[model samples]
Target: MILSQKLFVATLTAMFTFFILPLFFVEENANDYFIGFVVSSVTIPFIFTFGLLTSMLIGNFCHKYHLKKIISFLLHIVSGVICLMIFAVYIFITGGSPEGYIQTGLMIALLCITVFFYIDIVMKKKSK
Candidate 1:
C-alpha cells in the first residue's frame, strides 16, 4: 500500500479504537450518551478537518521556506500540547474526574504524537 494510504488507515483506526471506544466503556446515562455522541460526531470531524487544513498550510510553508526537520518536530510538539489542552477543557466541561481528565488528556497527547510521527515518516519517504 502507498504510505499515505496506510497512514490514513492507521489514523482512522486509532481514532476509532482509542477515542470512540472510551465513550462506549464509560457509564452510559442520558447526558453522557448525548455528550459522547455529540463529541464523537462533531468534535472528531472538526479536529480532523483542522488537522488537514494545518497540514496543507504546513506543506505550503515547507515548499516556500524549506523548513528543517527540527522545525517540524517543534511544530508537532506544540500541536500535541495544544490538543492536550483542548482535551482537558472537554473533560472539564463534561464533569469528568481529575484523574480521568488527566489520563484522557495524556492519551490524546500520545495519539497526537503518534500521528505526527506517522506523518513525518510518510513525508520523509516522499522527500526521499
Candidate 2:
C-alpha cells in the first residue's frame, strides 16, 4: 500500500487501540465510568481525525516548499511533544489518578513513534 494509506490505517488503529480500548478496560465507578468512557470514545475520533488531517496538510506544505526533511523532522518533534502533553492532560482531567495512566502514557509514546515514522516516510517520498 502507499505510504499515505499506511499512515491512515496506522492513525486509525492507534486511535482505537490507544484511546478507545482503554475506556473498556479501565476500572472506575460503573455508571460514571461508563458515561466518561462513552464521552471519551466519541470525542477521541474527532481529535485523531483532526490530527491526521493536519498532518496531511503539513506533508503537502513540506512538499510544496521542498523542505520535507526539515519540516518532517520538526513536525515529528512537535507532534511527539504534543502527544506527551495530551497524556499529561488526560491524567490530570481523569481525577489525577487514573488506574491506567501509565499505560496511557506508554500508548501516547507509541503514537509519537508512529507519527515519527509517518513523517520519515513523507520526507523520503518527497526526496525521491
Candidate 3:
C-alpha cells in the first residue's frame, strides 16, 4: 500500500511534467510560448485538482449508493474516451500534432492518480 502510494505520486508527477513540458519549451514563437507557459501554470492546477476532486466525489457517491466499482469505472472511462476523442478532433482541426494527444494521455493518467490520491487523503482509502 505504501509502495503504491509512492508509485502513484511518482507516476503522476512524471505525467504532469509530460503534459506541461512541451508547452513550456516547444512553441514556434517566443511570445506564444510565454503565453502557453503562463496559461499552463494557471490552468493546470485548477483543472487537475478540481477534476480529480469532483471525480473522486462522484466515485464515493457511487460507492455509497451500492454501484459496482467496475460499472462506475466503466461509465467514467467511456465518458473519458468520448471527451478525449473530441479533444483529439479539436486538436487536429487546430493543427496540433499527434504527440499532443500522447501528452494529453499523460495528463489524464496523472489526473487519474490525482483522483485516487484525493480519495486516499480525504477518505482514507488504500491503494490496491
Candidate 4:
C-alpha cells in the first residue's frame, strides 16, 4: 500500500506537470506535440525517481515518529517549501525561462504536499 501510494504520487505529479500545466504556458506550434513528448520523456522519469525518494522519506519519517495530524500537516508544508526551493534552484541552474519557473516551482510544491495528503487520506480509509 505504501509502495502504491508512492507510485500514485509520482505518476500524478508527472501527469499534471507534463500534460496539464503546459496547456497554460506553451505556445501552439507545429512541433509542439513532439516537443511535449520529448520534454515528458525526460521529465517523467526524473519526477518519478525523485518523487518516490522524497515521498518514501517523508512517509517513513511520519510513520517512525508517529506524528499527529497537525504535525504531519506542518511537516508536509515544510517539505513542500523545501521542494519549491530546490525546484527553483534547479530551473535557474538549467537556464529555464524565468516566466515559467514560478508556476513550475509552485506546482512542484503542490505536488509534494499532495503526496502526503493523498497517502494520509488513503491510509485513514484503509484503517477504517
- Best-performing candidate as measured by lDDT: 4
* Clash count in backbone of candidate 2: 0
**lDDT of each residue in 1-128, candidate 3, tens digit only:** 43454445544654755665565345488897777678558656654555444455556677789987656656556544554565567667889875666565646644554554444454334423
**On residues 7-123, what C-alpha lDDT tens digit does candidate 1 reach at each position?**
484466455456555653557578877776786686667666665555556555766799976675566566666666776777778887556656665666566656655665665
List per-prediction Cα lDDT, in the order shown.
Answer: 0.62, 0.60, 0.56, 0.64
* TM-score attained by model 1: 0.54
Colliding residue pairs in candidate 3 = none
List the candidate 2 regions with Cα displacement exceeding 4 Å: 1-7, 11-47, 97-107, 110-112, 115-128
Worst 10 residues of 1 by lDDT: 1-10
**Residue 43 miss distance in model 4 (angstroms):** 2.0
Stretches off by above 4 angstroms in model 4 are 12-19, 30-34, 77-87, 94-99
Supply candidate 2's per-residue lDDT for 68: 49
Residue 8, candidate 4: Cα error in Å is 3.8
Query: Candidate 2 on 43-63: residue-level lDDT in tens?
Result: 566555655666666667777
Give the Å shift of residue 22 in candidate 1. 6.4
Task: Give the Å shift of residue 16 in candidate 4.
Answer: 6.3
